[model samples]
Target: MTACGLPRSGPTRGQIYSGSVEKGGSTHVVNVDDRVNRAANYSPAYGFGSDFQSAGQVGADEVRPGDVLGLSIWENVDDGLLTSMGASSTQLQQLQVDSQGYIFVPYAGKIMAAGNSPDELRRLITEKLSTQTPDPQVMVTRVAGDGATVSVLGKVHAQGVYPIERPTRKLSSMLSRAGGVSIEPEIAVITVKRGGNSGKVWLRDLYSNSRNDIALRPGDIILVEEDQRSFTALGALGGQTKVPLGNEQVNAIEAVAMVGGLQTSLADPKGVFVMREEPQSVARAVLGRNDIYGTQRMAYVLDLTKPDGMFLARDFVIRDSDTVYVTEAPMVQWTKTLNVILAPVNQIRTTEQGF
Candidate 1:
């Protein structure tokens, strides 16, 4: 009954090994060893390069178009050009900078406000109004507006547009202004998009490495997201599902333990396999060949019964999208067959004794 293909979980060791060379099969079955463990230890790099780290904090309060400014002008004479109704002072509130970076005043005509500081614009306005009024006093101040602001979104407590203030000019500070990330710091990723350039770094890296805390720019968009790395667990195991990587790095032993270690009653200790696609460089190093191109399919076998198997599994890394499978023991099927054949016999014997 067992030879007639009795029910079992996943393929057996023989099937997996033989399938590697069979027609239409591309998988290469290899045993987990120290050499294979070193070759397959591949991890994708994540960080903000020099392009993002080189920028220093810039002047956050620099005026720009779309900014709102308030101008207060005072003259010694009660009937001065800017004064009104015999008053010696005049207030112009809600003075918005036009698209061309210019703002108009009553006697000052049009003054370029975008590229100048508040003090610079104030001096320029005072000089212009002096021609019509005696020693005109002018004050310019920046108000809340859309200029020099950044948009923060994704996995944060607050998602909105924030102005680039003096204290919130750096990436980390801006994230704090948005109430920080809601996800786990270990798995959270911060992405900054400026113009046509974009960069990403782990939330922990932002503080661990000072260079990652780059300066924030106007019109920049920031997004915080959780890590998406995960592996699939299949066959004779406590839980067969896609398991999210809980840590930054995970090994084969840890991966199996996460899914509730192999089912001792029905699992074959020698048939454990970790299946994944290996890059050309890694495949060449593992197989000692130069014919490899693109990615190649690989099924690494782990025999817990061997003396060095446990160590090999401990050193072997489980990468994203990899599959960990454990086949059922050979005797499990025979036991099921016997149970199916003798169930009726046992029932009939019980009925005879009752009669």
Candidate 2:
């Protein structure tokens, strides 16, 4: 029977949990070092090096729908066969790129213009006209830009949609163009959404490491958000206020110090536990490792009583949504027992005095 209520007696739930765990119905217990090593090996799906989208993969000034271009074609003689074909006449006139990403040119019919830059279009047009006329000159000019735009919103000093006027301008440059993040930049979390998928990058990390400064694509939504990552502290510890994970990573020892260490007189220092559900990345990384707990949830315990336990705690890192629980000391439980037994005696004495 389990520790909860059951007819047959077997391994209690407590024994199963803290002692020999059942295969199907047990939470796995892992040492602090094993847990830390697994976490260290885990790489995030969306963060600094996420291969979501690359910048400058295409030209910034590349042609797109809703753009106007000036196309000109000429033969050796000023008013020759090219002039009669409507090529010379269309040079002075601007042609709008259609919604279907194409433009009509004399003799050439419809040309795919949305993916090619002005210079690229010019060279292509010249090659097409070479068969009809000798050394035909071609000119392509972009009159307007209606395709390259990005939106910057949330927690920024100024939130608005800005156009990426140049190919070299990227994600970081766009944030600067929007007047950058709010007064508290350190705690800002920037989210980039592109093509239905999104990823987050800490502003502090972006500022410190250039590698995190990825390129921006047109129609990309850049949102500056507050750092909402946090952890909870419970039992024999300070108030259960939610502690923010902040912009930078924090180790477990630092987390304990920040929340005020365990209640010295009442907490079992040796029974400190960090309870967490395994993240998919971490689970995948440690799945085949025999030394690691393969369960979905894990309770990483630290015995502060041992000198080396403090060292392990120092190296252990606290993750978001985790709970740092410090169990009560045995003496504290004994005190609670005495208080319950003394309550009746105190009440009886008070009633007698009242008579």
Candidate 3:
């Protein structure tokens, strides 16, 4: 017997043989066939995946002003040898290298600091200081300064400029410092703009296993996107629900589960429907053989009758601003009606009898 106490039956033959009255159990066989047909046609169409790659790449060489300049200098001194060094300290005092990539020092005057390591800066400074003090000491330090400010905008707790001090800064670390992404995962798209350029960085790539490196530069803007679309889910399963599709996408079965899954007494379990708007732009793109953003304007119908359907649930990712709906069993309404009709009559009889 099945869990619901229905008899477990083996697979039957074809329609004519199984449903014919001469073969016996014609109504049962016919119903089974109808159910299969419904399940086959009920799968939803829309899903999710990588949509675009125009976002700018995060490379290591993007440096800005107010960035610390660490320096060390060594020179031949009359009293043995003297070495002096200074690490960039304050946002204001951080060495400001000019457009020509030269930093001005007290004694060295103007020396190139860009594209040079601490040891290199020390050597350069030593060369300049040596001209005055016979054997001058040298030091280099990239101090903490205003040059390393990174801007984080969009769906973060505190969207503004963040200072970069370490050798490497990660996307996740930056987001955490900026108060993290919003609670709504789907509506958020983190855009990292390099050098004030309009291009963005893909959040997925930063989170994924491949090439998870985002070297930040000064003036990079991270924009968090808000939820842009709205969708509704209703039907046989649990209660109807409405959800907004921000930057992320959702799928059919997942949508059903989100609204509390099928109400055992009211849900059919096998019937589900996803209704969505049909936009002309999407159709035009599809017809013109253009790559349309897959997450936009699509719906799906799913049947969760069989065990294997569970696997499909994962592959069918949903989009931001999509809807899911489940319909109730046909007999549920009749059962409710019968209960309502009997309630008044039972109440009247009890009142008259004072029971």
> Clashes in each model (backbone N, CA, C under 3 Å)?
0, 1, 56
- Across residues 1-355, which tens digit of lDDT does each residue of candidate 3 receive? 1123322121112322354434564221112223333332222222112322323333333333444664544445433223333432212145666656777776668876766666666777777767776755555655654555688887788987777645336666788888888755534556666643443434553566333345555666777776345567655545665766444445556666777877787665555544444354543332343454343333333456766555555445554344455555556655666666788999999999995
Q: Which parts of model 2 have CA positions greater than 4 angstroms off?
A: 1-20, 33-46, 50-58, 70-94, 106-108, 119-141, 279-295, 350-355
- Model 1 clash pairs are none
lDDT of 1 at 69: 93
The reply for model 3, stretches above 4 Å from the true place, is: 1-64, 67-95, 105-109, 128-133, 152-160, 175-191, 195-210, 222-230, 234-241, 244-250, 260-317, 323-355
Whole-model lDDT, candidate 3? 0.52
Model 1 agreement with the true structure over 1-355: per-residue lDDT tens digits = 4446666777877778878934457898888788888888877767776877787665876788899999888898877886777787888999999889999997678889987889989989988888887888888888756778999999999999998889999999999999999998988988899888899888988899888899987889999999888999998887899999844789989999999998989888899899998888999998878988889999999999999999999888889999999988878777888887888999999999999
For all candidates in order, the CA lDDT equals 0.87, 0.71, 0.52
Candidate 1 local Cα displacement, residue 146, angstroms:
0.8
Q: Candidate 1: where is the Cα deviation over 4 Å?
A: 1-5, 21-23, 73-95, 98-112, 123-137, 183-187, 279-281, 334-355
The TM-scores of all predictions, comma-separated, are 0.80, 0.76, 0.46
- By summed lDDT, the worst window of 10 consecutive residues in model 3 runs over 7-16
Span of 10 residues, lowest total lDDT, candidate 1: 1-10
